[model samples]
Target chain A: MDFATLIQILDSTVRLATPLLFACLAGLFSERAGVFDIGLEGKMLAAAFLSGAVAAVTGNVWLGMFAGIGASLLMAAIHGLASITFRGNQLISGVAINFLAAGLTVLLGQNWFGLGGRTPALTSGGRFEPIILPFAEAMAPVPVLGPIYSELISGHSFPVYLAWAMVPATAWLLYRTRFGLRLRAVGENPAAVDTAGVSVTAIRYAAVAICGVLCGLAGAYLATGLAAGFGKDMTAGRGFIALAALIFAKWRPWYALGACLLFGFLEAVGNRFPNIDLGLIVLPAQFMQALPYILTVVILAGFVGKAIPPRAGGEPYVKER
Target chain B: MTAMPKWADAVLVPLISLLIAFVISGLVILAIGENPMEAMRIMVSGALGSTYGWGYTLYYATNFIFTGLAVSVAFHAGLFNIGGEGQAGVGGLGVALACLYIPWPHWSLALAAALVASAVFGAAWAAIPAWLQAKRGSHIVITTIMFNFIASALLVYVLVNILRPTGSMDASSARFAEHLRLPRLNEILALVGIPFNNRNPANISFLLGLVACVAVWVLMWRTRLGYELRAFGKSEKAAVYAGISPVKITMAAMLISGALAGMMAVNTVMGEAQRLILNSVEGAGFIGIAVALMGRSHPFGVLLAALLFGFLYQGGAELALWTKIPRELIVVIQALVILFTGALDNMVRRPVETLFLMARKGR
Candidate 1:
């Protein structure tokens, strides 16, 4: 391949990383607030189905995006209700949400769309189109990087920009704002925050709601942005990959984006590695597919120093009498 | 989250949540063009109507026994073994490899070897999370989910690279020898003239599952080890104060749970399918957590809960054949069961224990 082709490949790789970046930041928010939001996949799936259906019906991408986010916020709310309000087992509640979403969406999708496992195929009008940057097309006239500008940097869905933008916004919200301080305090010691007059529930719920909205956006990206419609499990295991990113990042927003890009780089590699001919590295495609999970396990199993979540990441705060 | 429970809330909460789930599910189904009542009818008849139908349900239930026991065992140790699917897959993979490659002629010996291999491999897979938690205080839930993905990926790779059976669309290992097939006395019920139709190999594993259930009961109730494990589950610091090693107890609990999960593969391969094919026990590992939760994490409860799960599964499969409903409805039913289980979970044992304590106080 020429230099142009190589650059184009690298650019498109970031395109593929968008949804993952969104979901990882989503996980970062909920988990950092002491909620074990393990049902990211379910939230993404539910959002995908809802967005696809709504987009197909309404023929409006933004509506679909909002609807998808709305679906996940509802899911996140349930997570909050169960884990925080009712104080149920964090893991079980998350698992239940996943199971509930998996079955419910499929059951509803098949009947509504008349597809065995999908919604109707959406048009560009009904979905996101890659936005071309102004004068970037003119920049394409330059040698060696023209194809790269057109394919990678110039043309990609709008959510790609938003996903990138979220990194800084999340960092600011989580580190610079008064809300961020309260969130940190709540995760570490709700007692201290409660004594200081912050309602732990309100802060935690807002954090979780943000988490849900991101998950919804991730789902919308998967269905309307990436593929133009929802496949049965269109989000596939991408939510889980986002999860892998969250763990690798150790619950920090900016780190999660970097982790997502790295994993998304692997994912992009998995999609293209068949073309690479390393003389004797005859590792099966199957093993390559397992790379993300393997990397996650290796990370979790102490390759990184102490994934020490906020001192109280999974605990619910009940005020002392 | 309180250890103690109020009486009025106990039964009503689970039932109400369950009712809400059903109503929500019904709304979804109605939105999708299916009748809720008709679907329920199909589900019940499909699981309970006939002997053959019941046999299939039992087969599903048999695996649940192990999965439930596996989850219950881990829950006791404060480890959430969510890798039931991956662990079961590995367990199935282990037995398949042994049957296809290991040089064993005697039927009983082959079965024993296969079961042992599965138990060890399954146990070993579980120890990854166990060691991580014990050594580094890494979160078991995340680690376990990560393990499930790794196991899933590894299973796919193993099937294609190593275990590909010839002339098959399904990637699987070579078929088990007939001698290794689980024996069926479901046919032998004819000797007393109470003849049953349908000749399926519903083998002695159900009986073995029952035995495992009893053994689990004994392990949890009759042994001092059980006492220590339970004490540790209730309060790790207290257990340590009582002189029990938290690490040792945790390691033992996880391994024991993994071993039981592995044995579910034996029951599937040697007892029924007689072959360790791909996706063996399928989602039984996940369903096992629900079983354990519903059973309130007691051995006897796990047994009864597994049977309930098996019944739904068998019924679900049968319902598909007889009705126009998709097989995925079974998944919906399983989800419902789990949702209800979680809703009921916080109160299940607390009240009964409270009652026992109250009686003791009164005396």
Candidate 2:
């Protein structure tokens, strides 16, 4: 492939993968802290609606970002209260959150905006623009990879950078910091953490809240970064994909990025294959559409070998009655 | 002023949960400028309006019966089979393929071929998660949820390309032959002077559902394998100590659940439809979870809850036609039922069990 084409592919891949990376890390945080966060999709959807609404009205992208995070925090708080505190079944609670967000968003969106299924398209003035660093742009003059650096790597919204940088930050936070230790401890053995004088509930709440924050950013990435407007069901099971990434990554923050990139590549290919014309390469657009999920099942079932979850993963911790 | 017995928990809990959900839904109805009282009344009448309505309601109930049994079967074996959606979807795909691709001279042959394909495909889908959990110790929850997405994508592909019916953008398929369909039960009932004479396909699936429910009860309570599955559910370690192979039980449970869900393909796709179509599963597999939960994982309880869901489905559609309120209110109500039932404490369990027993005996 030509350098320009390669650059285009890389640029598109990063832009697409950004949302998944944010979501995977979000799941990573919650799961690592022992709270199963299956409600990330719900949190993201709710935030996406709120973010677009705020951005459209005030025309302040930053305010919309904050609003998105705030909306997701509220969702995360509900999950925390139900699952971590009340000891509700995580799966049920997660499903409830999804149902609630889906119903509430449509209801309120229909009432608030006259639009049927989508928000009014936002202008560039309300979107987060891609930032190109001077040094990266300077690399464009060379022959072999210059176009790749300039066209592919240099341009993208802030979240693209943040998603990459969050890996190390999450890695250090998860492995290097005291909070990380407590979070891992809570997930591994809540009782042990409790005996060590750490409040398992509080740690879990914090972890889940962080997950919400990242999910919100991911949702905004879908709207402002990917499509520039909020579409009903736009998240479209991306949250579930993130969950798959978390599973594939075995709940590690750093590895989660790799997993997301793989999924992102699969998704990019699904979007890309419709253009390529070849015998045996031709799949119905819908089958191509489902390729990622099919791959996820295959991977989880056997293709990716075995995955080991935390010992105390699905169990709620409570002091002995 | 007498205190309720703790043993009445099951029945009481679901009832209380409904009361709470109604309170919440009432607030929602108020927000939309409709009277909650009028809305609820409209909903009830819409669901139970005519004999034909009951037919439609029965039709909805029949699918849930198979799907609910699918969910409960796994619960009885201590495996949460969340791949109901995927398995059902796959079964539907198989049925659609058989109906369209099989060049049988007779419709009965096509029907038989379609049904067999559906059962086999559904069983295989369920087998994947079972294999993962049984052999690899993979969590069924994550794997099954992943399977749902995979199923959606795979179905979309088949619907759009391979199975897409002529002159349709909706990713639907061509209709199966008329002879391949289940004969109208309303007409048969009409011959017997039955109350509902509408020609809807809401026919014998409910009867079939009842038989299966009873069969499930017998299998679980009376059979040797049932005891083994229940033992595994209650205490895996103890069951293992007793020389029960959990691996086999887990795999068998998932396969049965998948097949049960696949049986629902008949009610929705083959039995009900004039032709094979895309996305025939219609999220029934996912809704099965609610039925299973509301039924407290009991086969008979699942039957009643499935019927209740059928009523809501009918009511939801009718409410839209007859009232200013959105039909989605019924969906909200259904969601409420799931939430309340899932959260029902011991307070609801005993009463629910008692009621369930009374219903079974009454049946």
Candidate 3:
């Protein structure tokens, strides 16, 4: 209710929303390219574990991030091989990837670290440090805008800023570029795009690779930026939440930012207040935690509006003779 | 659709896929500095060598049967019902209330009441998503997945506030009344003059699972509703043209699926734990997806797939207990099975089909 609490809540929202933002944007790319990826959670988990393990060993956050991205890209490649190359069921492939990630992460983690599927906590240099923006100290004297700028915007790890910046970058790439036009076309009507001399498979693989890169950043952020180490299933259900946000945002980059922030705000509030007493009725923390999923279901049910997916989504495009 | 014989299509493909998965899993074991052959021996001996092992394996199989059938039913209606985890969790609430509050004179009577209660609760939980998909055009996969989370949270709230015994730190209810406890499999076996592992948790619910499998087979193949459900799943527009209501079929299929998922509570809650606890369903709901897929969504196939998974589960536990193989590797193995049999079926099928076609041509 007070200013400090409000600022704290907003700050937490920024931190929590960063991963969701990266993942939502990732899903946006894949889905917009006609791949229904439910394996985002698995990819993120793999990256999180790899990043944390590599960071613990090398003591370099950048190297850790590279390893994380490499790991995620490998997973994306496997998904591509199964779904795109083999022309298999995309959903089944996604589920397999998820299962593989969940198992392999813990198995390898236990093998290497022996701390029960968890990497050792990274030291300062191994993790992403918060960046204090220029003039933050001097601007502290200013009343309303000062603390907001310094506390809320200034001191986040690099990925937070990268994720925020990616919104526009994604928008530009998705709308302003020729590749974007083809990608959207591939998702909606691949036959038409194929007729135009475009290779649907190449475009789809590119989209999935881009998705892998973003998911790698998101997973790296969770381990190296936010949590310092990776535990088993640390990404939890955030990938699914990101998918929900993708649907909630209607597969748009800008709307994904809003949906991620909203979901993040809900999580922050739930963490801050275990039980909310509003003088009349008390709300349980579990209710708050469950709110996003409940809201997603409501939205998908068309209580809010219709969320129509790409026409060619989920089906492997078959070229006609 | 293939020139291959039905036996080869049904049996040969899955056997080859399973062999491939196990071979890959064996290599993984070797990578972990363990003997692959030794691990296989241990897994088999631990899961089936003793009565104790069989008890646990059957217990796990019982849970899989219920959840697998749930997925198979929904698959028939072309719905991917991934909310089995949540549905089973809510079903536990039904089991808890029935066992704790009702003064059933016998376990049989209590089991009957709990069956209906759990089914109704699970069906109710799945109804919203089914309705949304049927009417509002919402994707059932997304809604059902979201519902799984909601179900977990709801169960937690109920257990923490209402079901937890007073002054107890555990997020579990007090033990159910003695009369409500289902008979363990050992007791039933003893009546037939056979010795069994008395301490093992395998219970009469195993029989219930078998019955459910038969029931599902009859419903899916023998009943008119099953015809309509399958018809709708094959092609919705065609079904509509044939005068079958998509809405009714979707709701019916989902309801039956939820009910089957919910029935898993009977095995975990009344048969084994004898009380409601958080995480009672574990990941059986997700495992059901793989089971259903591997089984080709057929009841008989589901039964075999469930037993295979049950073996892996119980064997994985033993491996963890005695060997260096982490329990999570079993999940990797299961995932590989699913990947080969379900996702990459064409990889093997194509080669085999070609072989079969060549053989026919030679003949």
Greater DockQ among 1 and 3 belongs to 3
Q: Report the C-alpha displacement of residue B134, candidate 1, in angstroms.
A: 0.7
Tens digit of per-residue lDDT, candidate 3, span A77-177: 98887778778778878888899999999999999989999999999999999999999998877898998998998999999999999999999999999
**Stretches of candidate 3 above 4 Å error?**
none
Model 3's DockQ score: 0.79
TM-score of chain A of each: 0.95, 0.94, 0.99
Error of 2 at A75 (Å): 2.3
Best by lDDT: 3
Please give, for residues B1-363, the per-residue lDDT of candidate 1 as tens digits.
Answer: 443355424444444445665676667567666687887687677777777767777778889998899999888867688877777778887788788787787766877787788888888888988888887777777777877778887887777666777666777666777666655646546655665545554666777788888888899888998888888888999999999998888888888888889888877877777665667777889999888877778787788778777776776666557654556665776676675567335444455557657876788
DockQ values of all predictions: 0.60, 0.40, 0.79
State which docking tier applies to candidate 1. Answer: medium
* Model 1 chain A weakest lDDT span, ten residues long: A268-277
Q: What is the interface RMSD of each candidate, in Å?
A: 2.1, 2.8, 1.0
Among these predictions, the greatest TM-score belongs to 3
For residues B1-363, could you state the per-residue lDDT of candidate 3 as single tens digits?
568999999889888988998999988888888898888788899999999999999999999999999999999888889899999989888988988998899989999999998999989999999999999989888898899999999999999998999999999999998777788999999999999998789999999999999999999999999999999989999999999998899999999999999989999999989999999998999899889988889999999999999999999999998887899988899889878887788887888889999999999
Better of 1 and 2 by lDDT: 1
What are the per-residue Cα lDDT tens digits for candidate 1 across A231-318? 8767777878888888888888878878888887776776776434578767666666667777777777777665667887778788
Two-chain DockQ for model 1: 0.60
- Candidate order, lDDT descending: 3, 1, 2
Residue B15 deviation, candidate 2, in Å?
1.7
